[model samples]
Target chain A: MTVQEFYEEVGGDYNEIMTRLRTEERIRKFAGMFTRDESYKALVQCINDGNAEDAFRAAHTMKGMCQNMAFTRLYQSSHEITEVLRGKDLESAKQMLDVVTTDYNLVIAGIEKLLA
Target chain B: METMEKDTILIADDAELNREMIKFIFEEQYNIIEAEDGEQAINAIMENSDKICLMFLDLLMPKKSGLDVLRFMNDADYIDYIPVIMITGEATDETDEKAYEYGASDIIYKPFAPNVVMRRAKNIMELFEHRIYLERKLEKRTRQLRESREKLERNNEFLINALSSVVEFRSLESGEHIQRVKYFTQLFLKYIMKMYPQYGITNEQAILIVNASALHDIGKIAIPDSILLKPGRLTAEEFEEMKKHTIYGCELLEKFKQEDNEFYHYCYDICRHHHERHDGNGYPDQLKGDEIPIWAQIVSVVDVYDALVSKRVYKDPFAVEEAARMIMEGECGIFSPEMIDCFKLAKQELFAVTEGKFSFADVMVK
Candidate 1:
């Protein structure tokens, strides 16, 4: 599948990401790099470990990655959780983590299929 | 002294993805340096401070924060030279203000656009480059100004020596006489300045006085050979003509008088009044008791001291001790009592100069 098709399938913004990366091959390469990014896993582990600060940092980092990739679906959820954790609302962060997880999984799966 | 040919951009962030994104944006133009955490960022800055001209600092890191890096740069004064662009996923007003206060060049919010960040970086680098270029230009101009001033001073010195030598040659005296009088005037002027602050003679004024003393006999250039080069005692008529040398010197300086030139005043005063005495007996103007400028008084005594201690066609050289005693005792020429004290203070140095034991250049260099 094309990178545009993958962004569409994962509910990301193809035009926004293309505005930065320019070429399809460059977009594919950078999009594929997101598969190995551990900010999602880091966020999950920090939330489980009751570490609000590290969890906020991880969520914030993941939000940046999502925005850069134009993964708007995941970026929105990660942004919410990052703000909640920033406000020391670990309980609210845990609840929002579910939505971020669903969005992150969809983007990761699309990147894998696109790269493959 | 560090070279400015650094073509490296340092990407300091804990997130590998962020570092990669930034590297890709600038890879075509710059070599990328990756620092995974804040500690590594500071270490990278320390190791390659000379090689890295720009930095993309992530706000949040494991070991340290972006603010910490800025603080380090501020403490080391590297912030003035290196442009730091802060990149962050989330920045509040307070955090952004704090980053700027810590010397961040610009703040690029996370998911920063390639075009915008590139534009910001280029503009800042251009400003710093222009500032450095202007600074170097100013330094070069300052050096050129100083060199030309020194050259002008050397030319003035050469001109004075040439003019003084002409007068000495015309008077049938050796060339060293003018230089010796100038040296004696310098020594006596300095001693008088130390022993008598009432004169309020600044160092600049003293230097002008010494230079002007060389032209004290400049008037004698107009005197005819019958009066100036007379081998025996001058007749009353020829002695009157010889005394007109002082007035003739002032007339010669008037031909070359320069408006706004402070050096001219000292030259004119010394040439016209070097023969005047404190007791109102010396010519060509007998107005006495401080009527003669203090600088002329200094040149007057030094001129006599030099003449007595040096052999002439008219008389043999007197001993330095005898010359000093004669001046102090008011036997050779009338002088102020305070001037006699200054002469006593300078007797040792004067003797050294007369005996060729010390050169003025050595004293000046020290």
Candidate 2:
């Protein structure tokens, strides 16, 4: 459950981020945040409350965090939900929320495995 | 390692984790300020405009959007002064165009690669610092140019005054004679400026007229010792030679004429035409009425008044009252009726100035 294993588990582009940051220590610190991040929970709550604007904001934020942390699968699913909610396509966004939640769960589990 | 203070960078986002991540990335290089919402971001930018050099703005936050902050910055003209980079998780073409239109320096998508964020932020900060350096340099250069111009103007005044004093020394007249003439011309020109708005005299022209008045008798430098120093009245031929001083003065000043040198033109007019009579009967050009240059007309009245009140080798000085009468009576030479009127009106002040009863510096200070 090292940084390399986490990158491999989530299929994240570790090398790409490391090229600029140039330090595994910094990347490790960034990856460690995923364990405590609540962006996905906020997104789910907004979707449940039928607040498409706040839901879009939450999804968008999670998408960015996933991208930066190289959580490619979760980033893609969150990106899809963000676009739908941003366009105010509430029904489509509501449907896509399930897909986002599934990817979010996979990312969380992968990070937990790497940390353990 | 160095003792210098770090530049401030403001990170504004609704998410605490996002703020912390960004702060961790930049804290080593910059002094970081955190704002949890767009409103706090704006407040930080307003309060620390001088200190904060760069800003990372979250596109969407509770209460106020990043675009709202940008709108306020644009309204206050703070956007150009402080560079802003928009951070958005869901960037679209519409939002991108609007952010740029509102003066966003750049846009960075959320979940940006750490390396990409670092490079982009560093490049933008460097670019803004370079721009500020250029602006300060430009301001300093402009100030230096203004100071040099002022120095040149002072030098020009000093050289002209020195040359005018040399002319006074050669004419056997007291240096104060030229000083009185200059002051009298300034006083008369002031009255002309107020009473005759149609003349269109500017302050610059009035100052040039005063400066040039010091050289009104410069032609006497070319006059012969016998006629110039003669105690007795000049015969007809000698008188004719004496009158050529106006033409000689014009020739002396005409040598300095060059393109766009308005001061030289003033000197030429005052020296050449100051003796010309308003009634078309005076020596040299005999320029009558308005045909005479206004500067010369002003100098002519002051010169005659100064000459009459100051003792010359040829005759004793007359009283200011008697000189004013002779001018009005057309005994010395006919003048512009307006000149005569201004002369009479300014007589007491003129005498006070000439006789040392009042300082010309007081009139100048006013």
lDDT on C-alpha atoms for all candidate structures: 0.86, 0.81
* Chain A alone, TM-score per model: 0.96, 0.88
TM-score of each: 0.77, 0.76
Please tell me which predicted candidate would have the highest DockQ against the true structure.
Answer: 1
Task: Name the runs in model 1 displaced over 4 angstroms.
Answer: A1-14, A31-67, A70-116, B1-6, B37-54, B58-83, B89-105, B185-209, B232-239, B278-283, B286-294, B313-318, B325-346, B361-366
Q: Give per-residue CA lDDT, model 1, range A1-116, as digits (tens).
A: 98878889999889988888788988887776778778889998999999999998888888888877888888889889988998979999989988988998898888889988
Cα lDDT of model 2 by residue, A19-80, tens digit: 64567777666666766777788888888888888888888778777766767778888888
Worst 10 residues of 2 chain B by lDDT: B1-10
| TM match of model 2 to true structure | 0.76
